[model samples]
Target: MASTAGIITPEWELPAGVQARLTTRAGGISQAPYDGFNLATHVGDNRTSVLANRRSLLRQLVGVRSVQWLTQVHSNWVVQAYGGAVVPVADAATTEQRGLACAVLTADCLPVLFCRDDGRQVAAAHAGWRGLADGILLHTLQQFPDPKRVLVYLAPCIGPSAFEVGPEVKAAFGWASGDCFIAGAGDRWLGNLQRLAAEQLLASGVRSISANTDCTVMNSERYFSYRRDGDSGRQASLIWIES
Candidate 1:
């Protein structure tokens, strides 16, 4: 529930030992387009700048021992994370170890953070439309003991008004997705990514949910949106059990 210059601490009533933060596109040294606080290493930002930004983020994390970063393939795959140099090729990561942070990178795609009510475990998922419809959140939740005992935080993403998609995109979620999409231009639908995510979480028995409703596409000063700008940098959402 706290916000600093470039970091947003999600407003969820997690256990005392669980901590989470999402980075905004501010307070970094990268140049235009990539601009400030871009965290993705594969997004064409300068190597040195990206490394420096990561170090700055680590410093802000206080006692975090290490952060597990994923390759994020837009798939439903979830992996057990241990903070180390080897990056796994998965969309979501979970960890029960204290001081080890799990993180996901995104621009317009949704980033969902999860933590158990008892503060024993934490997870992060990169939930782009492809991954979300494929059940990335559910896969991540499977790493926990029970869905009902987990709290979820949906990060800022491209909002409904800006997320126009073809009918085939809506078909991915089947009949339940119908309410999450509104008619857009001819043959197009304005999809509600957050709503879809929330509905899915609810269906999975997760009742404790909160979100950052800021639209990445609309809020140019605070976020990076791939749909708004073709080539863009990425922000990160991270969760961990504090030591």
Candidate 2:
């Protein structure tokens, strides 16, 4: 993987043919608020700017032919990506085809990438608290032939210190969540998205797990956080197999 500015390549021990990268809020022409490198078109960023930024991102992806973008709805739905302009309405996508990138957009929500040990299959998921509680990661893992051989990468997201949730949110995960939640003001709880995701993946038999804990809410200069900035732009986490 080439180390490019404003892009993060996972440091996990992935197979030879797998490629992955996560974009930060940098190196784009978007104006203030949306600022730079906003990849999501659903947000209020100008359509032209969003497209320009996406094209710029595509150029950086060396061997990638096309990226599968999704219209995320915070559900557990996972689809087989075929690399086209048609945006599927799903939170996660998987692909066995080379050069077809599977991608998910997020601001503060956790973005998880998956690839088999042999680098034959890859997937990406957008996991918010609701999606996690609803089993988004598990659903994505199901797309693979064997969960045990899949390598998982947890990208930057809202950290425990910054993600305050209500009582219902904590109740959703029940006792399996363990110390992933800490007592907060009133009936709120400070939740750790990455920890919750890791626990879920481990429980599902996935052993190779790596994470980037750079909290999006805390790193205003490098990330976009919806919880921090209401109308903020989104970054993308993508994975693919080389052609």
Candidate 3:
């Protein structure tokens, strides 16, 4: 496990046969801004350094599968991956193939992972406001066998208190969003991306779920927050099978 400013590092755990980790600001090769431990190569982090950091991340986990990286345009698109598929571009990745790490990168946006309690399949999705509003989690849920049989684990992200949005962004959810948004000063609204994700999960039929309460924006010493600092590095929320 890596450490960022040492605030958050590999914080949560999935059930048996399922393995998961959320990276903080530590243990990487990138410079400041995209500082040490940044797993996102696309966020202006140098190519070689990002690759090296990713390699280092893999080295830390013995027997873990290579992470399936995504292009992540914030669309509702999701991809299905084989056990050997590595670094495919898509907002979400699902697998019946064991040992392949279904992963998503985030700096305030939501990264959600799901799997059947049986561990025969798994998935990860990148859901920023756009994707979340467009039903990305619901799309991922469609890939599951039984919604209630699937378990959801939310990785670290910008909390509602720190994630203020414009009315247009707030209107994206309409009434379906409900209390996911709270009043912010002026015309702004505080959106809880994590809670919105949970609502979507339940709507999609997922009954079991757990969320990481750490707010990336508020806890700057730990996870990265793109909202707080423009052009920031990204923390990875990843999951893979043990068998």
Candidate 3 collision pairs = 3-26, 4-25, 4-26, 28-37
User: Over the stretch 56-126, how does candidate 3's per-residue lDDT look in tens digits?
Assistant: 77766545767778888988888886645355657899887666787789998898988788878889999
Residue-by-residue lDDT tens digits, candidate 1, 96-121 = 88999999999999999998898998
- In the range 1-243, model 2's lDDT, one tens digit per residue, is 334768878677788888899999888989879989999998889999999999999999977989999999999999999877789899999999989899999999999999999999999999999999999999999988899999999998999999998989999998555689999989989999999999989999998899988899999999999989899999999999988
Give the CA lDDT, 0 to 100, for residue 104 in model 1.
Answer: 96
* Model 1 residue 72 CA deviation in Å: 0.8
The local distance difference test score of each candidate is 0.91, 0.91, 0.80
Clashes of 1: 0
Which sequence of candidate numbers ranks them by lDDT, best first? 2, 1, 3
Would you estimate the TM-scores of all the predictions? 0.98, 0.97, 0.91
In model 1, which regions exceed 4 Å deviation? none
Better of 2 and 3 by lDDT: 2
> Which portions of model 3 miss their true places by more than 4 Å?
1-15, 83-86
Residue 65 in model 2: shift from native, Å? 0.6
